[model samples]
Target: MRPAHVIAAAGAVIASLSLLSACGKDDAAGGKSGAIAVTATDSSCEVGAKSGAAGATTFKVTNKGSQVNELEILAPDGKIVSERENIGPGTGAEITVSLSAGTYKVLCSAGMTGRGPSQTFTVTGKGKATDPRLDAAVASYRIYIGEQVDDTLAKTKKFAASVKKGDMAGAKAEFAPSRFGWEAIEPVAESFGDIDPKVDTREADLEKNQKWTGWHQIEKALWKTGSLKGEGPYADDLVNEIGILKQRVGTASITATSMANGAKELLDEVATGKITGEEDTFSHTDLSDFKANVDGAQKAFELLKPVVQERDAALTSDLTDEFAKVQKLLTKYEKGDGYVSYDTVGKSQRKELSDEVNALAEPLSKLAGVVAK
Candidate 1:
């Protein structure tokens, strides 16, 4: 007979593995039990295994194309069973779910907007109990979160420097790439909370005003060189704008530091491969750690938002709304489709949103004078 300790250790390992499998899949290279590969282009869903045994199963989703995307596994009852967000370009995740012997749907979304397609699959036998591989993936993902935070801070600093130089062209060039850095790590942002109340109260006036807008106006004013007959005054305004931005950058730095330190602890565990024992048990501990760090970071951002808004309420509000719209557009693909293809939402709509936000910055710049008093 097996030694009692060995048998007990085996049981523990099995249980731990079972727990991890339920969390989600983390790779596209298909697992031993089976695999499903999905390509999200123009918003469509593809399933790897149309039929399988019930119990625990993993779906490996890949964005085999350009565009940011996400995948969701939904029960037949329209309930979301599992999801992975901000999967990024050319990357994928394995999502595991439990199913009774029946049918299920895989949903996909392209980009942030709520647009995409879904596919369904059927399960035949009562599924096998959860597997160990799933747990290992979850533990590994906890480590991925730390790398994301480091990348985000690095990109943010670069963006801030571009803005400081009054290099609008360079600033614009850095925008999308920098935004991707944040997007990759955003899942962790939820771990943090809202901006500081001290800052929130200061910006309440602008937040309440739906009409306030931000970046559009600044872009127009800065870009319209031919029409800028009053270029000298406009340049002065740009100088003031940059000064306010510097303050915002300072606030962002504080928020980043808090998140980075928190993420480092979790990343160290995964990077060092220190996780051992039953897979499920290890994953539970890993996930809990991930959430704690994420929550800490979320609180930091929540506290920071108000400070950012206070720098120029009108401008900040406008920027806030634009960011909201863009984010909303991206959330659409949070589940079903993994590839996001950008269709013009129309230059006019984009302009309207941008212009409104940019206008707020002007009045916001004036706040520097008021606060100095």
Candidate 2:
């Protein structure tokens, strides 16, 4: 979800990520405990360690830069292995990822745009074994994401067929429903860097001379022109890209901690884009997207609840209540199946939604640490 217009909300929307752990805990830091230290500035990304044993490793990411920044570990093929975004100046966050023996790139994106700085890191030997319950959680999540992908692909194909047939009203009607699955499992789709930019890039996020193709490109044509003229090619491209996404899902590498972090990232998606009315700009179907994102986050939490409950039942209980609160608030605006147009939502109501998201995000941010423990 790259949109130039939405950066203004970064400070407020993403500040919760800074509290990934409790106060005064360096156990997650790079210093004596084998965790990697990553110090980021506008001009540099300094990683304290060059190599480590392969297993679950934590990266203590600190943003020393003047602007808000993000840290990411990418595979050799350029897919994001793990990431922590919207780290404000002088704040810190931790990301715990399961690493296999291989070479990886630790990259930092200053101001959350363009690649800022990166370095090579290596892992040797299969480090440590994983818990059986953690393994089960990962397995269950994969099945869930596969189901979402199947649903998305089916709906997108139907929407594409409508456009190809020049059925303008039919295409418009099918548009928002087509995107529900993609929005739900977005973290997986976004892991494959090349596929997301092609499949979901908004027009404002289009780079110079880059030919835009994806949901938003077609979204613009459908809502603005009220016609599907010259849109057949883009619709075909959407189907093809989603097909790539389906294949990639089978090979996705995910740790238990990553699933928790991804749930937090989905809430960030809501605060930054959906709640701010930046996601479904023309269609005004932001609430539908909001519900999908929350549902996805809830699914991830539910799968991991076994481990979390064993460790910290209180946190688990708090998360369940917070998620239900947000979902219940959304229910008020429900139309027939989807939500009412976003423009119809007034300022006071929007504030209520934002407040509920913030409440959920605080407890949600601690999920990664609890699950990793």
Candidate 2 CA-lDDT value: 0.83
Give the candidate number with the greatest lDDT. 2
| Cα RMSD for predicted model 1 | 23.9
- Against the reference, the lDDT scores of all candidates come to 0.39, 0.83
Per residue, candidate 2 scores C-alpha lDDT tens digits across 249-331 of: 88876878889889988988888788878887898989989999999999999999988999999999999999999999999
Candidate 2 — which pairs collide? Answer: none
> How does residue 238 of candidate 2 score in lDDT?
97
Error of 2 at 252 (Å): 1.1
- Give the 10-residue window scoring lowest on summed lDDT in candidate 1: 195-204
